[model samples]
Structure formats: C-alpha cells, structure tokens
Target: MRIVEGIGIAVLVLLAALAVLFLRRLVIARQGGTIELGVRLSTMVPGRGWSAGLARFAGDELRWYRIFSFWPGPRRVLTRRGLAVERRRTPDAAELLVLPPDWVIVRCINRQAPVEIAMAERALTGFLSWVEAAPPGESTPETRPYRYKTG
Candidate 1:
C-alpha cells in the first residue's frame, strides 16, 4: 500500500541522515587539536546553556562545532587576541548531570565579551597553555610578565 511505502522511504531517509552525521563526527574527531568541550554562550543561569561540541585549536582561533550538527564548519570561532581567563570553578549539582564528572568550568573574556567553557582537566591544561603561549604583542591575562619581589 502507499502508506507502507511512504513509511519505508521515511525510515530509509532517517537512517541515511544518521549515517552521514556519524561519518561527519568521526572525521572531525580525527583532526588534530580537536577536543570534546562544552560551550555556554549565555551565563545568565549557571549550567543551563551548555552545549556539547568539538573545539579545535587552530592557530590563533578556536573553532567550535556542535556535536550533532550537520554543517561542516565551526558554529563559533573564538580568537586568541584580547582573550583572558577570568577564573575556574567546579560545576554544581545541576551541571554535573549535563557535563562529565571530571570536567571543570572556566570563565573567560574574549574581546571583552564573556564566554564560559567546560572541559576535562587535561584539556583545561592544554587550553590554558595555549592561551598563555600567544605570540608576542598578543597578551592574555596569564601571559603578563611577572613582578619579582626584592626584599
């Protein structure tokens, strides 16, 4: 019957779309500098705006792509210039449900705009190192010259 054929075609289309998404994720994960991270665009409510994504550190840009997205490009690209880390904290009860157990939250200011990133400890270390390793003349908060105490 026509109804049966329609249902069958719909199922096939759904499966094909799923396959494509899986392949895309595989390819993206295979790229170097790619790491699984959660990005919160809005910090109005803690633990409410987190979206799981793949973040790639490319040169001076951090490109983020949603894990389930079909698009081949990054959804958000954060630049290293004028980026500074404000603080780091552990997630609350609600956030733990959405984020991994070992992940930590980091607040940052990018070009004076607030951005929150959630990632595991190792990834956090790498991120901090990257931000601090900016090229000369590109200053992040942690990259400033240290002042020595002369007693």
Candidate 2:
C-alpha cells in the first residue's frame, strides 16, 4: 500500500511540474514583442475559427507575439494611447494593426485583461484592402514622409 501511494504522489508531482512548464512557455510567448501597424480580415466569425485562421496566417506570414485576444464591438477603432505605449516600450516589435475580418479587435492586456473590441467587418475589410492596394513606392504618412517619385 505504501508503494502504491508513493507512486501516485510521484505521478502528481510530475503532472504539476509539466503544468508549470507549460504555463511558463505561454507567458514567455506572450511577453517580449513590438507592435506594428498592419491589418487582417477573416471570412469566419470572431471565435475559435477566426482565432485559428489568424494564428495560422501569422505563423506563415510573419513572426508575431501571440495574439492575446480580440474585441468585438459596434465600432472599429484602435486606441491610440494603448498602441502608442506598447510601441514605445517595444519599438522593434511589429504592431499588428488589424481590422479583424470580423467586427472585433483581439486585445491581450497584461495577461489578466483579455478582451475583444467590436467593430464593423466591412470597415476592417476596407482598411485592410487599402493597405494592400497601396503602391510599394507610396509611403504611409503615419511613420514616414514623402520626398518625390524616383521611378
């Protein structure tokens, strides 16, 4: 009986250790990344389907800090102050300026505050389309100024 009890305790300890390791990995993955201006639209709604698709696309297209969560609301607007602070902290990190395919913005605030801001899908689509359509030579005014057309 003592041998069985000892084995059970050992198994519990192993499981607990594994859980801790997994959580650590999650935190490390969430922290340490810069935010950039970029947008993405999804055909699916804002839930598991959209999240999965976004994850797959991010993995394939660019290296990003894990998407904490998305917010769905009546309007679509990225908080200037929130993003500004994040950018200031991690200048090198790419900020995902997303107008979610759905009416939502995935937001992960300090691990404890995870939310989905709502917005219009059409609005997000239009914004993303514009960004994609912009000519390579044309510069966005947000971060750069135009000099002249070289080509």
Q: Model 1, which residues run further than 4 Å from truth?
A: 140-151
Off by over 4 Å in 2: 32-151
Q: In candidate 2, what residue range of length 10 has the lowest lDDT sum?
A: 84-93
Cα distance off (Å), candidate 1, residue 131: 0.4
lDDT of each: 0.82, 0.32
| Per-residue C-alpha lDDT of model 1 across residues 1-151, encoded as one tens digit per residue | 9999999999999999999989988888888899899998666785688999999999999999998889999989888777777788888898998998899888777764678889998998899888778788667335433321211
Error of 1 at 81 (Å): 1.2
Give the C-alpha miss distance for residue 52 in model 1, angstroms. Answer: 0.5
Best by TM-score: 1
- Output the lDDT of residue 106, model 2: 30
Output the TM-score of candidate 2. Answer: 0.23
**Per-model tally of clashing residue pairs:** 0, 20
TM per prediction: 0.86, 0.23
RMSD of each: 4.7, 15.7
